[model samples]
Structure formats: structure tokens, C-alpha cells
Target: MTIKSFSFSQLADMRIEGVGIHASYSIDIVIKDENSSSGKNVYISATGKSNAARAAGTGSLLFWCKVRDLLSNKIYSLERKKGEGFAVGFDDFVIGSIMFHIPYNSSSAPKIELEAGYLYDAGYAGTVIPFPRSLKRVIALTQFNRR
Candidate 1:
């Protein structure tokens, strides 16, 4: 099996503050081939501060990261679960980070787009920071031998 990898770094810091919550962070996304499978794996890691003040109420605060297959227009949203590598700190008011992974089949086309940001209360209010236009990556996948 052959493996290919791609990495992306944010061009600018992403910041969103509202309803007593605020998040400021930088993101890094990596796409690589799975060692034992034909599919690819997406890894996202965001580092900085994601916090909700005591007055922000008891609603859940989530970090949102998504990837779009430009060829198929399929969007994959990263899940927020501890077992999936999603972990962020709130109310601490200190710099921190979060990460998650998504597995997907290789795209027919060579390019993909990514967007990252934060969401509060499952859509109450959120911000999306898209990858820079120039950063849309063109990836070359290794052709697999068919039995």
C-alpha cells in the first residue's frame, strides 16, 4: 500500500465572540492515506483559546470543522467526542486546543476545500472561516491495484 499526505495551515487567526462566548484560534488540517485501507483520513487540530464566560449560560460550546470534496460537493463535519480526539477547554480562559479525525474515500478530482470555526448551542450563533482561496489543495492519490 502507498500513502500520500497533505498539510494546511491557517493564513490568519480565526476569532468569534458573541453571547458571552469567545474563541480565537489557528487551525491545521492534514489529509493522509490510511495504512490498511483505500480511504483517506482527515486530521484537524486547532490551537488557541475557546472559552465561554459563566454568564454564557449552560448551553454547550463546540468547535466546528468541516471539509468539502470539491469534486463531489460532499461535506464532512467533524464530530465533537472525546474518543474521536475532540477536546477543548471552556471557562478556563487560557490558551488550549482541540482535534478530530474523519475518514473518507478518495475523491475523483484532485482538490478539496476546508472551513473551520466555532458554534454555540448547535446553531444559535457561529462563525465559519474558510480556507484561503489559494490554499485549496490539489492532492495526488496513489492508484490502487485491483484484484
Candidate 2:
């Protein structure tokens, strides 16, 4: 798959304090293998960090993801904390370790544009450190007969 990512603003590795909004980006995924089948596993991932741990009552890294399949004309979207839940300490964060399954009836390599955004939680005004991160992979996966 060919992936092209476009960011409105390059997330600089700068310390962010209080309520802040990071950049937004769009990822374009192209399927090169014509044999790739529906229900194929497409991995979409985002990662970043914070300057300090967010308080229990507050959120640090908030992320939003929207995916659109041009071939099937279907759209999937979700939003959640980057750490997947209330987190304190441990600068690392992920979108809950999830994989996006290609929708059915997707014979042609569906053109997908994933839009993502990052925001710092209010109230607690946590500090965060932005990082450049976007992972997308397309692979034809089939059930194993031996299994």
C-alpha cells in the first residue's frame, strides 16, 4: 500500500502547557496488490508523549481519527485518549492498540483518507510534548488452514 500523509502543522517537539491544540493531518492509503481481499487487516496507529503526567482528573493527549473508504463509500471514525484511558506518569501513549479491518465489498484498493487531530485536555491543563507519528499498513491476511 502507498501511504501519503499531509499535516496542517508539523507537530514540533515543544513543551505544551495548559489547554492546547496540536496539528491535524490526513493519511492517504493506496492498495497496490489487486489480489488483496475484503476484511483485510489495515493497521492505523498514532503515538505521542507528554511533558509530565496528567493528573487523575485531567486528560493529557486526546486524539481523533476518521477513516473513509472511497471504494465502498463507507466511513469509520473514533476518538479517545491517546493513552487509551486516564493516565498518570509513563510518557508513552497509544490509541488502545487497535487494527482497522477493511470493509467488505472492497475489491478495488479503496482510497482511504484518515483525518486525525490532537488536543490537550482542559481543566487540569496538563503538559504535553508532541511527536511526529503516523503508522498505516495494508496487508492481505487469510485464515490459515493449519490453524
The per-model lDDT (C-alpha) reads 0.40, 0.43
lDDT of 1 by residue, 1-147 (tens): 333343344343223334322333344444443333444443333332234322344444444556665555766665454223323444321112333222333534234566555334523464333223123344454432232
Best candidate, lDDT-wise? Answer: 2
lDDT of 2: 0.43
Candidate 1 residue pairs in backbone clash: none
Per-residue lDDT tens digits of candidate 2, residues 1-147?
A: 433333233333324443233222332223221223444455554443443224333445565556665555566765564445543336544433234555555335445655554555544454442455433433333321221
Candidate 2: worst 10 consecutive residues by lDDT?
A: 26-35
- In terms of lDDT, the poorest run of 10 residues in model 1 is 92-101
Error of 1 at 17 (Å): 9.5
